[model samples]
Target: MPAAPTAAWSLAEWLAWQEQLHPKSIELGLERVRSVALRLGLLPARAVTLTIAGTNGKGSSSTLAASIYREAGYRTGLYTSPHLQRYNERVAIDGVQASDADLCHAFLAIEQARGATPLTYFEFGTLAALWLFREADVRVQVLEVGLGGRLDAVNIVDADAALITNIGLDHTDWLGDDRESIGREKAGVLRQGCPAVLVERHPPESVLAVAEDLQVPLLRLGRDYDFSPRDAAWRWQGPSGALDELPLPALPGAMQLQNASGVLALVETLRGKLPVTPAAIAAALRSLQLPGRLQRVGACLLDVGHNAEAAEVLAEHLRSLRPAGRVLLVLGMLADKPVEAFARLLQPLVSRAFLGGLPGARGLDAPVLQARLRSLGMETEACRDIPEALRRALAQAAPEDLVVVTGSFVTVAAALDVLHE
Candidate 1:
């Protein structure tokens, strides 16, 4: 589109300027990005790339994998999307966020290289991250797909191993309205003859068909590999072998075992290239942390679970925690999410729910979400914003009771901001 707003701008100015270039915020396709990437040599050449795509566990799985790689002494480059609080959280090299100066430099280079090619904000950020990772000469690059696997900007690079965490009915408008259609779109990340890991216990036939058609050596959960919880820890059995007495993930959720299992399978798939010791795996599991996914901040527990599947996971986590008192919920959801389904899953666990309005196109109003919960026969309170909702939830909860701020990432982010303040 038009030239960048100004020259020699800061990261904030550059990000705001980039957002203006694309007509739509999220335009999914690779042609425009691929052309610019080819010009800038942004594709991964030397590094081992692992592309992760899913509805819920993608963040945790990617974090586990990247942390293990980092623990193994590899220069790890990770690129995730839709940062909760800071844009800088999206790209990191060797466990450090890319500096604002570094991102600005990369943005300036892409701005010059793209010419008339109108790149979406995500496309530009993806290219910049790849370029930064390449320039840094990182040995292991983990890219999380921003949306559907096929058309997501990160999928432009042919990953050495593709990890599909699990499929759910989120992003139906862009990806299809059902799990099978979503699975087919996610299965696009699988490459012929390359190793692909599907950690979903019951994967869609479309994904299996795509893997078969592409001749992808698929390692599926339950069939190819599985994990079972022991008293305290879990045991992972894969094609490579079984690893017993593994430490539970430190991410504070029972569902993390499922995510960690996929991570372990991917580790096994890439072990030939980047071998990690059992010690490293154990260490990574014990040390791994991801914010806004069942994260605990002071007295408030925060989860960025916007869909029904994620709500199921959150419910499981809350049950495992076994809070002795009431579990008050401060919730805010996007307009497109299955608010009723999510509410149904979590309502039983929640003693009382406070609804808050999130801002932007996808956000649902607080009163609207409160009415939805009330319709579900749940106790509800409506607040103007996440801060107010969190305040009310905390006020309602006793010291023994748990206060959870959840629903969408924006909700968690808002809670975090208010908590930090």
Candidate 2:
């Protein structure tokens, strides 16, 4: 049962209360949220909304989209999930997190409107973000779907344009087990006749089928729009036109170029309505930042690549780096993840591995992870916590060697906390 508040509750209080509101952390269907949204009159919005859904790259895509819109002089509202540190990080207006007071106010409004209805923590936050966006009078809103697009809370509002960055096997317990099923679930964000960008060069048939069924003008990678690397920079060509000599993405890795291409395709799709300048696009590309996806902090390289597809992308980045010394991996993952497959993908690159305990009910403890890795014929060291694992990795690391903290967002968040401390 949800806790009752007396007098005034702080943002933290509201968040804590919200956690206990629902029995399950994630209930994917949207009826409860849709009803609440209807009651609050949040449907049929003002802003030109861009909803992004993917197994990976959703954060990068959303960040790039918001920054591009901001550089174009539009007031942008960006809502992303699983904040690394602060809850404020989830809701950003013009690149600034919403203030505590503002979040509290939004929560209060939602509480008043919801009545007897219950909402998950994510659902509550989604509603609050939408409310905040509306109140801020944002010209454009970029929403990252928390889970599968079809029934995700963020899917309540129909998008003016949408992007499904890539369909990979993830959240299989909730979404189906195959790429085709996952692709169809993500393609739910596509609105009829809306310009939808499919970033995957080889997208699942179900995704394409959805786009075709809904009459969506789908711009696909290696099909409708494409990018090519030129040393440090890249070039993109799409239906609207071509952009040459574009700067390499501020975010590192080969995967980001693909993400940037999708973002550009989306920008081109909404060009008639938004009309961003080339200069703004260039500036945004060079300046955009998302915290956890392959962020380099001092000597440590942190990534939140937990699943097989993300692990493969991380492998690509590692192989590209080809460090002189060695790549020491400090890893922590949730219990439900495909640990064996994830560990096996990077086995060739990782010289040694440090497994750490993760918190929460779904956490896979260090011993289990260490056993899993060792069983795969990799050298493994088990540690009590993220800090301990990182400390061990750093102690053993040579100056030329790299220490990668990865596996899950929780893992990266913990590593970051220790790094900051």
Candidate 3:
């Protein structure tokens, strides 16, 4: 199914135009985007772009890296997928989202460039980001892959640096189930000799083999660099490098430590050329924030972790925060995911689970999902939607108690609109 159109030529016109071009939200093969890119001349001929791909933490890692570079005083551009509150959030320069006028220029450019040929919504946005960044004369561009990297649209532009954070089971229908298969697919972003940074404690051998075959500069965590705790702070050391004591990332959770390390390794690899100072790194992590990733909203907390691996990360963070009273969860997820795994992750941490149907054809029906909550063995209520779920949860809780809304980004955003009100 296609993403339903919701833009004016204003936002709507461009959205409707692009939606008609592509048959699917994701066409895994890169050939169409590559051809259009050549015609549109969208490919970067000469620019230092750091492309990142991973199942989780891609946005956080990109934010941290961009923030550090910006703090160090470089003109940096960041591109991430699936914006929460606004489409503008996907493209940013120095932490500011692109304005609607900028988005208009990009949409028009892509429309003219494509001629009669169609591009996916993601493809259109990728071209727009490149166009906007080039026009703005950005010093660095960090492009996060939207889906599996092997044939994702972003692969059209080769990278000066490529970082693959971690491999996990996701988009299983497109990629394979096994870790090694997924790792090999992700290794697609690596350029022949460009530096590729990885944080896998045990990276799949397939990824290592691909890197070896390509002679890519392999920077592995334990072998090339390592991060470990040092008293109250953390210490990171790279091959031919060491970053002294650093504070924990303000992003919260133990998973962020690994992500922070990856950010450091990438910056460290480009040190003199990128020239980021330790003070800049400290400031970025201390101030870096991404919406709806274990994020606090008024007295309620919201996160966009639906899959089991992400759920595990959310669980660990909740354990640390340990909100003052009994925990309450307002949960919604796609029907295809392991709903059981996510339910288990939250059931242990919260006192009651408020299930709801997310707003999409793929969303799991709330009442249908309720049966899965039985294993949770906790009090559960099925709400009509995210807003209703939030109303129910908030009415039952005191200001200090936990009211968590988790599952998908759509769920978080819908609830966030109410949380802000």
Which predicted model would earn the best lDDT? Answer: 2
lDDT of 3 by residue, 33-139 (tens): 77767776667534578899988889999999889989989888999998999999999998899998789887877666666666888988988888888888888
Supply the TM-score for candidate 3.
0.95
Ranking by TM-score: 2, 1, 3
**Candidate 2 backbone collisions, by pair:** none
TM-score of 1: 0.97
Which stretches of model 3 miss by more than 4 angstroms?
Answer: 1-8
**What is the alpha-carbon lDDT of model 1 when measured against the actual structure?**
0.90
Candidate with the greatest TM-score versus the true structure: 2
lDDT: worst 10-residue window of model 1: 1-10
State which candidate, 1 or 2, has the greater lDDT. Answer: 2
Residue-level lDDT for 176 in candidate 2:
95
Error of 2 at 302 (Å): 0.3
1-421 per-residue lDDT for model 2 (tens digits): 2357543788888888888889999999999999999888889888999999999999999999999999999999999988988999999999999999999888988888998998999999999999999999999999999999999999999999999988888999999999988888998999999989989899999999999999999898988889999987889999867899999999988899999999999999999999999999999999978888889998888999889999999999989888888999999999889999999999999999999999989999999888777778999999998889999999999999999999999999999999998
Rank order by lDDT, top first?
A: 2, 1, 3
Count of residue pairs whose backbone atoms collide, per candidate: 0, 0, 6
Q: After superposition, how far is residue 403 of candidate 3 from its true place, in Å?
A: 1.1
lDDT of 3: 0.84
Itemize residue pairs with steric clashes in candidate 3: 7-11, 7-12, 8-11, 8-12, 8-13, 9-13
